[model samples]
Every structure is written in structure tokens, then in C-alpha cells.
Target: MVDHLIIFTRYPEPGRTKTRLIPALGPEGAADFQRQLTEHTLRQVRSLQQRRSLRVTWCFSGGDVAAMQGWLGSDWDYQPQAAGDLGDRLIAAMHNAFAAGATTVAFIGIDCPAIDAALLDQAFHVLEAADMVLGPADDGGYYLIGLCRPVPELFQGIDWGTAVVRQQTEAIAQSLQLSSHLLTPLNDIDRPEDLPLWDAVQRQMLSVIIPVLNEAGNIRPLMEALQQVPEIEVIVVDGGSQDGTAAIAQTLGARVLFTNSPRACQMNAGAAAAAGGILLFLHADTRLPHDFPTAVRQTLDGAHVVAGAFDLGIQGARWGLRWVEWGVKWRSHLCQMPYGDQALFLRAETFRSVGGFAELPLLEDMDMVRRLKRVGRVAIAPGRVSTSGRRWEKLGILRTTLLNQLILLAYHLGVSPNRLAAWYRDRNFSK
Candidate 1:
């Protein structure tokens, strides 16, 4: 049974379609924007991994099949929109799709950029459980409307282009006793006002750069650990480490940069000097778990993901240390707050846009991590970095956990940073 996707697109000619957007974008600009919108929509649809039973066809309207064809590329199958009102065109399209041996049919307009594999999956999921599914768009128009078993009565006599589009569909479905499911509402890229937020989100991926300081004790050990992986260049930002941290890192085949520190300052400076697709912030004392390169590659693979870190572990096997590892992983997964000790990875652009790490003496890692979560999926992978537990061992696990949780609570409650710092200062639990 062929599952069908009908993408409804009007001709992208000036004075033909999308009139309201013209006042802001002008005729030529509107046409260009529409072309981009159509292309983006097509690209997203094309990226849908080939489902064995699904076939996609484009339904073009406004009597410019050639223009639509040019925009969609020659590979896509297209049909000119059959006449009547908007309802008639859609009804005809759905019936045509059904005629083409499609047991299930879905249609989308050339708008929403947020449309992705996940939303399409949801649509199919709903079709499995219900007779029909309607994806309500933010602009009062339904972006996607699908039917598994046709109830023509469900589509008839409905108000089009009004806020009641979704509401009336539900009413009809209820009145006709047709099973229906509603997909989550998503914003459509209709107006220029929406561009900045989208652009900011797109810019959030940043490359990672690690700046090392006073690391003669840890540099070679960390470098050797990193060398087990391939294609990852560990850029070392050296803050005049007289202990030969820079030389050790260079000898281990890492790209090294000499600089001065106050820790955060050196990291931010290194970020400025380094070259990579995404920047990962690493502590000199921490060592990554196995397959670290693969983990980094996965996190940076897509545009939707902004930054990610792994679960954390320490080099030792104390019971308390294991408990800490479990606790950190649980909290990171539950809240998506993967902290720096685990390794803070970001797309290079996002890191620069956010102005790198705030030059704080303490909590810079946590603060950077918290800000990253706002942009995209801040995920924690199954992999982990085996960091040193000396801090916890010296302070005692109970005291360290209590103090960390207290600081975390205070931070979330918006306590003054100065006061928090003072509180941290007064308590001298060994570092």
C-alpha cells in the first residue's frame, strides 16, 4: 500500500500568490522568498528516509506548472491543480492520491521550515491509531492534513484561511464520527519578524577549543588517551605552563597555542585563535572515555543539535565515585544539563555568538552549559569522560555533593553571583 505525500505549492510568480507577504517583501523579493520556501520544503521532504511503501508527489497550482517544476527539480513527480475553490483543489488532490493506490494520503503547504523527520513520523503514527490527522499551523492555516480512510464529509463546508480551520475540522470529524488525531502546533515561516529567532537558533552550533594551563602532571597522560582516537586535533591553549604542558601536547601530535591565563580568559582566547567546525571545552585534568571522536562526530552531524556532552566518570573505582557518576548521568539526562567536566561541545558559530565562556573564576563551565541548553538539544551520550575525582576525594563525597547541589539550587533561584562567590570563598574545602 503506497503511503502518499502531496505537497501543495502555488506558482512562485510575482502577482500570482502569497500576496500578503508582498507589502513587506515587495514583488521580486516575495517571489524570491517563495522560491526559497519551496526549495527548503522540498529538501526537507526529500530527506525523509525512503519508507518502502511511501511515495511523494507535488501538486502545483495557479497555472504555472513549469515554474513549480523548475523549483521542485526535474526528479519530482508533479500534477497541475484541478479547478474549483481551495477546498475543491484539496479534495481532488486527496482523491487523486487515493486513486494512485495510496491507502493513506497526507498533504503539506510550502511553508514551515521546522517540519522534519520527527513530525512526519508523528503523522504516520497517528494514521496507525486514527482515521485522519490534521497538523495545525500557527497562522490559522493547516500546514498538513491527512486521511487514512476517506470521509469526504470531513473536508466539506469548512471555512478556509481562518482560525476556525483546525476547530471546524475537529467539529466535522466529531459530527461525522470520524477518528482524528491532532499533531503539535508549529510556527510557520510566514513573516520577516520570525527570521531573527530562527537565525539565532541556526547559529548556535560552535566548534570546541581546549586551553591547557599548568598541566605537566596531566598533559601527556591526557594526550596519550586522546591519541587512541582519530581525526580529532586537540588544540592546546597554553597559558605559559612552565611545566612543559605545551611541549608535551605538541609532542603527542596536538595543535598547541601559547597564551596566558586566568582559566576562562585563556579558553575564550583560544576559541578566538582556534580553527574547527565545532568547539569543545575540555579541562586539562579530565580524560575522555573511549570512542570520544565518534561521540563528537555524532553531536556535530546535524543542524538541529546545537551542543552536547557525555556522561562523566572518574579514573578511579571508589563506590562514592561510581555513585557520583550515576547521579551526574541521571541529572544530565533528566535536565539536559551536561556540565563541562563531562566535556562541553558546541558548534563553533554558536560558541562565538554567545561570546564564549564568561570570564568567571568559578562556575564558568556550568554557566556556559546552562546558556547552551536554550539553543538546541543539549544531550548526554552514553559515552563518558573519566575525570579525576581528587576534588571530591579531598573534600569528601558527601560534602562535595551537598555543596554542589546547594550551589546549583542557588544558581537556579537567581541568587546574586557575588554572594554565591563569597559563600564559596568562605568555605575552604580542598580543591
Candidate 2:
């Protein structure tokens, strides 16, 4: 039989979800707890995978598929939960599963952690003798529902979210002459007292590398922000900053390394010292998306994709800044190219095999992107990375834009990067 498992869940947006638990956990706390439950449930799914070759589907609400993939990684087929009551959504999910060639289907939520791999296997085994299997929750509702075939009528006209939910389902099954089996009842942690039962889950570490030159004013705030992210280690590579940038970064608790090398060389040095399995090359004045960790992981998980970068968002009030953002998006998509300011990230092994960023003062990001494209596809994530607009503000948008295009053209026409670097230093904004 085409065994499929569908998980119903809501994206943990604060104040919008898990409201019943807010009084005890607060808004953000509730959201955090919801995320913890989601992760715990996923680990159990992984354990189930070790025993069965079942298709896993995520019937999600609150966020788009991209955001879901960014949060949970690119493993499950995410389908939007249908509109209406809980019963309506369940009916739709069951219908979708059967339509996709599933001979048997099991549905669940993140509410109960007691539904382990053994419990899931028992549900399928019960399906051999019964048309339906139900795992009753300690609460009035059930933790899980499974069916050997589509039984749409059994889901109709039930009082969802009530103690009678299990009873109603049983009555409906009896009316339809469908054989049913009941598994052991599990608990759904709705009250404050249930918090003690949660198991700890470990997340992967992300190593962020930033190459700086005389950015003392900006380094502290950037490090402070990066410090708030759990399991993230920040590496600041300073190229002999005279403005005490290294001192500020070190004081801010970042792992600081000194290098007399250029931008590409400094980045390479930082990458070599990183302890994480994944490496993200960030610009000194750029801010990554909030869900950066998940986005980076999911994008790299795509088939044939080895590296990825975010779209560019210039920070400015000028109307031309909007056009600049549009241009950056199109360039990144149509060109499959992104600059260092876009915050390029990839697995450590992939980067090491490619010999890291090339040692060049100018067009190094472009050169790296060109070489990377030869090995695998590059994924450009949806959210834009906000970068400092000081360059455009100082040089005027038109002049700054023209200068960048001309420099790129010259580099394409076989001009040496050393020559380009000299030209850049002479005309660089002296702010």
C-alpha cells in the first residue's frame, strides 16, 4: 500500500498562533514552545523513516511553502491547510492524500510527543484488520487518525475541538459500517504543567564570516545581532583596520582574526578557521534575513545545488533605491549571480573542494560565482539582504551605478584586477 503520513501544523508566528498557551508562556514564549513541539515531532518522523518507506506530507498553515521549507528544511511536501473548521481541513487533507495514489494514510499533529515510531507502526498494523485506526488523546480529542481508504462521510458533521470528538468519529464509523481500532491514549500538552515533558532537540551550527576594513562604527552592532542567534558562531576577519575594528569585534565576543590580505583572502582565512559544517560569507554592513539559518540550509538542500545567496536590498530613502533593488533581484535570478553583499553561504566541504574564494581585490565575488556555477546550480533565496547604502549616498546613485557597470565591463574585457583595484582606490568614496 502507498503509506503516507501527513502532519498538520501552524507556523509559530507570535500572537497569531498557540494563543491558549500565551497566558503561561507569553506571546514569544508560546511561539518558541510551538517551534519546540514541531521539531520534536519531526525527530520522531525521522525515527519512523528508519523503519518504513512512507511519504511524509506537511499540511501547514500561517506561512508560504518557501517559509515552511526555510523553517523545517526542504524534506517534506508542504501543502496549505484548507479553509474552514478543523474537521473541514482534515477532510481536505485526507482527500488530497488518496488522490495522490495513497492506499493507506495516517494524519497527526505536533500536539502529542507520545506518538512514537512504534505507535505509528501499530496504527498501520491495525489498518490490516480494521478500516480505520484512532489514537485517542488524554484530552477529549484524538491525537491521530488513520484510514485504509477514503471514508469522507466519517469526517462530516462532527463537533471538532471538543471532548466528544472521539465519540462522534466512532459513531460516524459505525454508521458507515467501517471497522475501527483504537490505540492507547496519549496526552496533549495544553496547560503549563505539561511543559516538563518536552525533550531537547539539537540544531545545526552556522558559521558566519565577515571581512572588514576600518568598520569600527559598524562591527559592534553587527556582532551583537549575530550573537543573539543560537548555534551561530561569528568570525570577523580584519585586514589591518586602523579604526580599531578588530578590537571592537573581539570585545563584542566574536572570534577575531587578523589578515593583511585583500577581501577574498581575508574571507578565505576566516573560512579556514570556521568550526561549523556550513559557512556563510557575510559583508560587514549587511544584515541577513531573520530566518537565515533555515533559508541557507534549505536552499543548499536542493538537488544539484551546492551554494546560494540572498537577493540584495540597498538601505536608503532615495526613490532610485527601489530601482536598484529590482535590478539586483533580476540580476541575481537571470544571471544566477550574486555579490558578496548578498551573503553567500554553502557547505564547508563544497567550499573547500572549490578552493574557497579566489585571492583578488576586485571582482572576486564575481569570479567565485562564475567558478561555482560550473560545479552546481546556485539558489537565490527570496528575502533580500540589506546592505549599507553609504557608497551610493556619497557617489550619487547614477555615478555609482555607472562606475560599477563600467568596472564589470572592463574586468570582462581582460583588464587585470590589480589595475581595477588601483582605479577603485583613486575614485573610492572618501567618507
Per residue, candidate 1 scores C-alpha lDDT tens digits across 1-431 of 56788888877788766667788778876776666556556545644633334687888876555654444545567889878777888888888888878888888987775676568767876787789888888777688888896667766888876778888888888887878887888877666775553354234323346677677888888777665443343567887787888777765655566666656887887777544456778888887767665677676665677778888877677798889888888889888877778888876777887778888756778888778777777877557787888888777888999998898799779887667777886887423
Which structure among the candidates has the greatest lDDT? Answer: 2
Query: What is the per-residue lDDT of model 2 for residues 176-294, given as tens digits with 9 covering 90 to 100?
Result: 89988999998887777776554322224467999999998788879877755544667889988999998778666566888876888899999887756688999889998897988
Q: Name the Cα RMSD for model 1.
A: 15.4
Any residue pairs clashing in model 2, and if so which?
A: none
Measured over all alpha carbons after superposition, the RMSD of each candidate to the real structure, in angstroms, is: 15.4, 17.1
The Cα error of candidate 1 at residue 165, in Å, is 67
User: How many Å off is the CA of 4 in candidate 1?
Assistant: 59
Taken over the whole model, the C-alpha lDDT of each candidate is 0.72, 0.84
TM-scores across all candidates?
0.49, 0.54
Q: For model 2, give the RMSD to the true fold.
A: 17.1
Where in model 1 is the C-alpha error above 4 Å? 1-208, 240-242, 413-431
